[model samples]
Target: MAFDYKNSPTDKTFMEFDRIAAEMGDIRLVSKKELIFIPSMLQEGEQVLAFTCGVMKGKRWLVTLTDMRIIFLNKGFIFGLKQIVVDLNNVNAASGETTMFSGRISFQDGAIIHTLESVWLKTVLPFSNKLRDVIELRRGMKEEKKTFSVEGDDFVSKIERLASLTEKGFLTPEEFEMQKAKLLRE
Candidate 1:
């Protein structure tokens, strides 16, 4: 079944999420509720991608995904909050699993091994997919940048070598131009 954010049983929680989203001008609220505890934990420039509320190890917990990190907020009955932030760069990989009545998020250094009611799974599962995609995309971009830098350095060295060869009369100016064009194309 499709998850309708507007009509979820957690409508009140969504209201709180909306308030926080308004205050944070650039952020898009992927999902939110009292269970997620996002407003209090989110950092500046971190965009919420997905979140869910549930219980883990007998303690109430809020699991959240943001552009830069994955966070777990353990809710206490009184006074304090325990927060765990996993930067996206440190996450080697992430995966999600769901049964009829619960969901799990497995990632580097930690996992959200809790079960949400089946009604909530529709929303949570898709969020998990989106989070994984974002993480993979960031990793791919970093790899591409590294490859491009290496190629750029190689191109510069080749040009220098071609210039030296021309000066030494090992290559004519026409040959140098042709080699330069070939390098640029590659």
Candidate 2:
């Protein structure tokens, strides 16, 4: 059968809902901030709509801020904006892994800055628009310094942690043995 466009599981869901000034949108006139809540019908899954602006002319490109990632759907691909800077790590979940979502260009003191680490940001922006300067800033605005002093564990600590996981049967025998040997060498 020929592919039925409607029936097939498609991959197009995110949209920037900034129909403000046209839809009674809340506008922060002093700082040019604007907000409009998206209905559940727009996105059926777990998502967020974070705000980011594309500056060039007098246009607004609102960004969606969700728990996992930021989605940008730009209409004016060219002659609109070349680069985008998104806030990274603005996701407001209690304790979720960073493996889920990406693509976020947040406002910074300079341009939309990107980091070498954020994998998710890279994944989302390229697909939405072909801008190269798009940066995935993990929670740019409110980045909290890690309270834990430890950055990485020493060999002994690695082994001890491994031992604990192994004892709990979290690791297979081969994995345990490899880790054990590595620990001993250290």
Candidate 3:
């Protein structure tokens, strides 16, 4: 049940994975001490160590994102880092007070570190820990003085702000879904 992002996954395309897996499937992956994947500097089947984020008590991960796709024990890859503007609405015409949903994925150590972020109601939020991690890691490296940004890709840097709003229950599920859907359309 892979998502057909090229054509946009329909509601059914997005929801069927769970049902199919629940009937007869098992999630599986592997872990290592330190995996290293240097883009364009290595061949396939090459990675030192890696781990799945959440699995059996944090001690093991049966599967994890390696390359741009989910990987298991034996497969391997070599890939370039890319940031795609998928799911955009009015991107060619965006000005202000626009809602957006987008992701910036990095290729490192044989994995795609996905930073899923969205914006709505003048607030931006990142809904994934990986995105938060990316923000923190980047923050530590640069001197972006604002809590969130109001510039290029600034919406993505505002995960904490969005999370705070979400915790305060400011955004309704419908709002979230609508904004998310709109972003995807862009």
Candidate 4:
């Protein structure tokens, strides 16, 4: 059956949630069974990387990190559901801090920042680290690609300069053509 967020089956447990998530795409269920509450929040092509669930200020909270986004689901009985979606591409940093009884996970995406607190430190700390690592890896790859493009532009400019020098008689046409060929090959 197709997954429905508002009309999720009550009988299905965490394992069933895993099955649903798997159906969307290849995914690693990083959160322990006890941590998952709103599995319907996950979207197609999103892979779960880490998650933690606990209580803060007498309310239950679930925070999840996925390849595509970070999700926060607040479990409230009378007030219904409140969900927050933070795109992984927008996230610049993820961090966590813990004391004896409470811990906080914070996410910063440009000018916007949000934090979630839970009483479970053991779960929060590791999840935070994993989340940060994934974000950093993504950022690094993007920066590397950007740097490569910049280098390509610089190479093209240098070739143009070489051509200009050849036109001004500073370099022979043969030498300029050879250098351009070499740069293009590299």
Candidate 5:
């Protein structure tokens, strides 16, 4: 069967892929076949942010980072295609290490550890760092949301507590009013 080009990467996307590969010291490191297939894997409105090629378990693979997740793709000579996906939210503690000629990128996803090896040192270090930064940012934003929700609950509880104190006569009405005003100011 002839391959369809309907969902293929456009010139701009190709440029982006090229740019990412260039950062790894070779503009052609990512094969055209891999680039052509990338768009088909993306969800609607999802975008490829960065990608690079590396080895995993002794096989060459295309490692892609999209707006939503990381995609690991390997096209085999005889067996067709393979893919591994990890959502951004599930990624934690990404780290990279480089030796003289190559490097490794590893990250934790839940209980599993995923590692990409034999990648270019220049690319692996920055890519791992960027991945860590993104995960940390998302975690920070999530924590902020939780804090805001808790603060909302706390504010309401403070008002209720002040009203309860007033009703029990432990705090005079005037004292309750002052506390309410103080809470509101806070």
Candidate 6:
């Protein structure tokens, strides 16, 4: 069942939604009310990947993983909505622990740690593993972009970037020197 939201989904969003349903098991762990409300909180172009209903600080929350970030959503009895968001780029690590019946998932970003407890044990491993994998993939892509940033720069600028990359250990000294010589010859 599709929930109504502010914007219509694009083809990319539909593909991602299908992938999430196939891989993560349809997000049935959260409530129907939550399902109805979640799309409203999502930014345009953001795709929901996985989610688990859990407790934190004695309040129930629906912890959701999206392509762009992690969202902790709670609708209070008296109050309206309380949400905490952790950007994908800010996630330093993800870990989980499972007991006989339930599990806990924790995400550490810098000095802060966000944890959701009482998740179904079956979802713990898959969710945590996917979280870690996504973080690694995003970081890898960012590094690759950085490595190719010297493109379109002037000759002197390219050599300076190579030197900087060498200093940062992204390039070896020999590789930097070789590239510098190649650029000089051009």
Alpha-carbon lDDT of model 4: 0.69
What is candidate 1's lDDT per residue for 1-186, written digit by digit as tens? Answer: 323333345565466556544443324434333445564556654566666555555666666777788777765665577877778877776666777765565665435333323224454556567767988988999999999999888889999999999999999999999999998888
lDDT of 2 by residue, 101-168 (tens): 43333233334332222224332343223222222333432233332224234555787788789889
TM-score of each: 0.62, 0.26, 0.17, 0.69, 0.78, 0.71
Per-structure clash totals for the candidates: 0, 21, 12, 0, 0, 0
Across 103-140, the per-residue lDDT of candidate 4 in tens digits comes to 78787988987767763656656777788889888989
The local lDDT score (0 to 100) that residue 93 gets in candidate 1 is: 62
In terms of lDDT, which candidate is strongest? 5
lDDT of predicted model 6: 0.78
The candidate that wins on TM-score is 5
Question: With candidate 3 superimposed using the best TM-score fit, by how many Å does residue 92's alpha carbon deviate from the native?
Answer: 18
Instruction: In angstroms, give how far residue 59 of model 6 lies from its true place.
Output: 0.8
lDDT of each residue in 30-86, candidate 3, tens digit only: 122211212222234422121232212212222222222233221223433322221
lDDT of 5 by residue, 109-174 (tens): 999998899987668766777687778888998899999999999999999998998899899999
- C-alpha positional error of residue 17 in candidate 6 after TM-score superposition, expressed in Å: 7.1
TM-score of 4: 0.69
lDDT of each: 0.64, 0.37, 0.30, 0.69, 0.80, 0.78
> What are the runs in model 4 whose C-alpha is more than 4 Å off?
1-13, 16-43, 54-59, 75-80
Stretches of candidate 3 off by over 4 Å are 1-28, 31-50, 53-127, 144-186
lDDT of 6 at 88: 94
